[model samples]
Target: MIDFWLAAGLLLLVALSFLLIPVLRGRRAQLEEDRTALNVALYQERVAELQTQQQEGVLDAVQMDAGRAEAARELLADTEGVAAPRVSRLGKPLPLLAAILVPVLGLGLYLHFGASDKVELTREFAQAPQSMEEMTRRLERAVAAQPDSAEGLYFLGRTYMAQDRPADAAKIFERTVNLAGRQPELLGQWAQAQYFADGKKWSDKIQSLTDEALKADPKEVTSLGLLGIAAFEAERYQDAIDYWNRLLVQLPPDDNSRSALQGGITRATEKLQASGGKVAQAPAAKVAALLKVHVDLAAELKDKVKPGDSVFIFARATSGPPAPLAAKRLTVADLPVTVELGDADAMMPQLKLSNFPEVQLVARISRAGQPTAGEWVGRSQPLASSTTVPQRLIIDSPDK
Candidate 1:
């Protein structure tokens, strides 16, 4: 029975080899035959035309003779002196050997290594499901195997996010940033993770990250939206307006997302109006009881020659838009500089900084050095030597 099976296998192998080798040769032969037939037809037509011209006397004898010679040269070159190129019997041996040997060698190797061991594809597939937990473990294994893969780190971070583990997600995103510096996707992911980790504080750090992301891709809607939220939180009403405005420009007019964004704007505008509608009238230049430091004017007191060149002043209700409330650039820098509330600076119209309460006062020589700008000299509360006194501004009640 073994001998009969071996003989039958050999017959099957030989039959397969015969069928495979002939198909290649047959296709090649067909192409060569077609080429030969086409060339023959073209040459015959040229020769017939030449003969017809000579008989009809359309061409003189010399021209007719020349055409016949040219036609003969082309015909012989194309046909290449008789039987068209045929498949070499010699070429048959290599394919015949490859067809017989390759499958046999492959089958032998597979039988020795692959077939002997049963592959549990179901178990393997089950081992790596789309669950974030399993995916994270799989990513850890893959990254451990190949530490330099950027893709592994990126996907791993995404998996952590999917798992609702922002702390772990932040760590993975940090790795991605270290490996691939400042990629837009990495920046956005890192920002999202950071935002979550910060107790969902969309106040300061979120805006910083959002700015970085927008710089990376100006059209990033998510970043822009977050930026609007940050502005709203920080009481930057006009900034909130500008951010949402740019976003609206890119979003489709009919999109419901627009209405959602408009709701944010309406809230911010109402907050701004509630805080203190545009600083209606500039405060009096020489208010008798307030002290203020002019940041711009203080810098001008460089290389101090005299003692009376600079003055100290306090501002009350100073935190709002910087320029004219009506201007387009309604962005405000850090304000509510707490100098002594009732000081001599209340007199100068140009140094009119006020709008806060209980601001105590002090003064220094800035002693003989290039008199630093009064603004850069650092203002502090009365009786407090340092400027680190954190003011809990009632952002909700600006007039307070």
Candidate 2:
């Protein structure tokens, strides 16, 4: 901000010069005109004195004429090299007033229309934010700057949820859904936020959102969790247990929320038993759209590659944008590892393994750790995301 202000001040100085420099030159010109007028006055006084002498017989006509000529020559010499006096229609104070108002008006217009807030936000984003509140403030400013940016609005909504401002989150998520086309994850988020913002009172709008989200993707984790909570609050213990159990299958093995979800299931089970309700057998886990791939390096390239070189393995929709839907990173030394790609490995909430029916598996060895370009690469033919058998990928060819 200081640097920006300094640059603006320099530009203001330049603008001021345009106004004040001409005024200064005009003052000098006025002074030159004054000197020329004084010289003429002096010459006139000398001629009058000579004429008086001639009339008194103290000087003859020829002497008076010669004196006048000498006076005229002196006057020419005194006024030599003086510029012609120019008439200024504008007064001195006009330019001065313009000089004063130019910068003031410029600054005012800039404050009203310029992107100073965006500049500050960009500067702040260049470094790590110190707190969640600070990050939230920056996000709010970003949303204000780019009102049509669905990605920005989505993040702001998530931040609002984290801050426990569910009402704000609900509004932001609604806008995000409207802009980004009501993706399953966004619909789920909107439903969760709206449910909480309504003071845990279920509404038809929330129900519609969750239903639409589940109808598109039954494994959408947010909507499942939200539904479980709503069922529990309604004292439908069996329903809560069923919803949570289904949600449990969608989560990755390392999900920290798994423990908390299991606790909820336990509580629901106990409540059902206390009410003399027979616990129904848990339903079979659905086959999720998880892909397991075995990655390896060609034996010929083993001698040419560094052990510490980065290896990026990802799955991307073959027909959509080239961005990875799910990704995993490792070093070249970790070749021959079998890894799973699923919704939990999604690079973003919207781009997930289950969202695309046909995806290709890719493996690359990038010394600089970039996923898009690398020295060696391997790609699989487009396959179903729900393929259960482990697939094989070998970095056997050059990236090109």
Top-scoring candidate (lDDT): 2
lDDT of 1 by residue, 120-200 (tens): 322333565766666677678777656777888889888877778888888888888888877555777787887777766
Candidate with maximal TM-score: 2
Estimate TM-scores for all models: 0.33, 0.66
Superpose all Cα atoms of candidate 1 onto the true structure and report the RMSD in Å to 1 decimal.
Answer: 23.3
Worst 10 residues of 2 by lDDT: 282-291
What's the distance in Å from true for residue 182, model 2? Answer: 1.6
lDDT of 2 by residue, 243-333 (tens): 9998887778899999999999999999999999978998664455899999999999999999999999999987655679899999998
Residue 47 of candidate 2: its Cα lDDT? 94
